[model samples]
Target: MLIGVNYHYIRPWYDEPYPGIHGITPEVFEHQLKLLGRVGHFVGAAEIGEALAGVRPLPDRAFVVTLDDGLREQYEHAWPILRRLGVPAIFFVNTAAIAERRVLGVHKIHLVRAWQPPEKLLERLGQSGRSGNGGQMGALSDVSLIESIRRRAAAHYNYDDPETACLKYLLNFVLEPAVRDRLITECFEEMNPGAESEISQRLYMSGEELRILSDMGCLGSHGDDHLPLGLLTPVEVQREIERSVERIEAWTGRRPEALSYPYGSAEACAPPVSGIATDLGIRFAFTVERAGNPDLRAPLHLARCDCNDLPGGKAACWEADRLFEEIPRREWYLDEHVA
Candidate 1:
């Protein structure tokens, strides 16, 4: 089976009482890598993307490692570990943030919430008119409260999405670019004054650094603006996807073959995206929906497990390991609404 593991941040983690935002720490990640090294043939995502029928069948334990988003954390903390362990992986990036030095919609929300309560931010958006309490914001843990505000207030924002993800839609799609940028800048400045100049430098890797990593492993597309492709017009989608490929190609001296969807879920891997990938010569497109690929002759629409959801224990390493096994039953998601 061909499996891909999806990871984002790899920062230091603690057993905080509340469900504070967390990711696998570098130490734990190395433990997981040790498990993978023992049980599977870990391959680069690009090689997996290229392994069509012309190649022999991959071992049942074969897997690829992938990191989503071009967070500076990965380029700093995770890459060193990957290099030390000789573990190859693909790092998918959003070039717009790199090029324009702007905060992503999610990060914009995060920066605000980091300093102020979600209720305060919601009040700022004036989403609920009152504080965000009606949605049970107070009952929820901090992380959950963020979702509460985003999802419950989405209706007021007139976003069509049914989940907490509507905030992304509102921030990235509903609001005009200039308007959203100003909001993010204002929020950022309030929290960390005089930090505007360092936002891009602190948040993402430089192009020269990316080119060097490409030489080490592979660099792939995660769109330019990092918005949901299904939500954009066909022309806009083309601009986002094509420009990412062009920018990465220009920097790395090779057109990227892999294109992991910007959220890598929902509309992230659907009609317009697949069509764009086909047109632009993207060999593989990844999704967050977890599954094992029995056949990879055509690498589009491949499933990946989020690192947070990655299982543990020695038995978890077996060929029939339940985590990697048991492909979750999915509806014809392509036909469903981008919820």
Candidate 2:
């Protein structure tokens, strides 16, 4: 069985007044790494891919640490702790941030939220004319759809407050992309004028840093534009994955074989997405589905647990007694769409 732990935003201090961006500090990260070391063997990024491809057998209780978003704080803070502990982990990056030298819209939302509370952010959304009582995106009027989004949001962002969760759901999944992008951009610029380039540079790892990680086989693709691939058309999804893989190879001189889907949600990792990854020669892909993978039978849809749900985290939910429970050998996700 494999336990994939996912992380984002590792920094020394999360000192924003509202502090929308949240993650474990270096001290907590190191502690968690050391604790995980006690129960499982830490493997490099590619090893898990190989294991899933049946090129090698995975050890019992194998754990893979993955940090998404390519945040520089990951390299500066998490990387050192990982290196000191000889822990091998993957740093999944969004190539657009590096290639275009601009902050991706998803990140813009994070920064804006960090700067303003949900009320203020929601007010901005309301002012957009596309946010009033199910204005254009009909999902707001569909009770079932709203419930579904809420369920997904609650599961994915279990740490967020209700208001914060609702705000994120609306911005990420409800509002139109162009409108959402424009609104977030306006808010981000208002928060930090003329700093998209500067912030993109500061927030993400540099090309040289990426190359170093690539040399260590620790770099993977998160996507090119950071849009939810499952929400896009198959052709668009293919473009996103292909562009990301190509840009990463161009930047690092080594093609990435592993990927952590942007958003990592069921919707984000849905059909044609994994199939596209397979066609692109991606050996394995991860989703934010919260469970330990019992086998590599469904390699591309491998499940991952959030760091908060594991030991030494702020909100640990893993069942201690079931650590070595018998894993059924059934394949649960092998639809025709999976390739």
TM-score on alpha carbons, each prediction = 0.78, 0.92
Give the local distance difference test score of model 1: 0.67
Candidate 1 has which clashing residue pairs, if any? Answer: none
lDDT of 2 by residue, 1-339 (tens): 888889998888888878578888999999888888888888876677677556888888888999999899999999988999999999999999999999999888888888888898866665655545335554355788768878877866778987788788888877778778877887788779887898899989999999999999999999998999989999999999999999999988999989998888777888888888989979888888777777777678887777888888888875444544632222325545543
TM-score of 1: 0.78
Looking at candidate 2, the ten consecutive residues that score lowest on lDDT are 323-332
Tens-digit per-residue lDDT, 1-339, candidate 1: 767777776778544332223356787777787766776788885456546635655666777888877887887888888888888888999888888777676566555645554445544544432354233323434677556656644733331334324444545544545555666667777777876548867878898879987886568888888777876778988999899989888888888888888766555566666777778988777877656666663466777766544554222423434544565533324354421
Error of 1 at 32 (Å): 1.5
In terms of lDDT, the best-performing candidate is: 2
Best by TM-score: 2
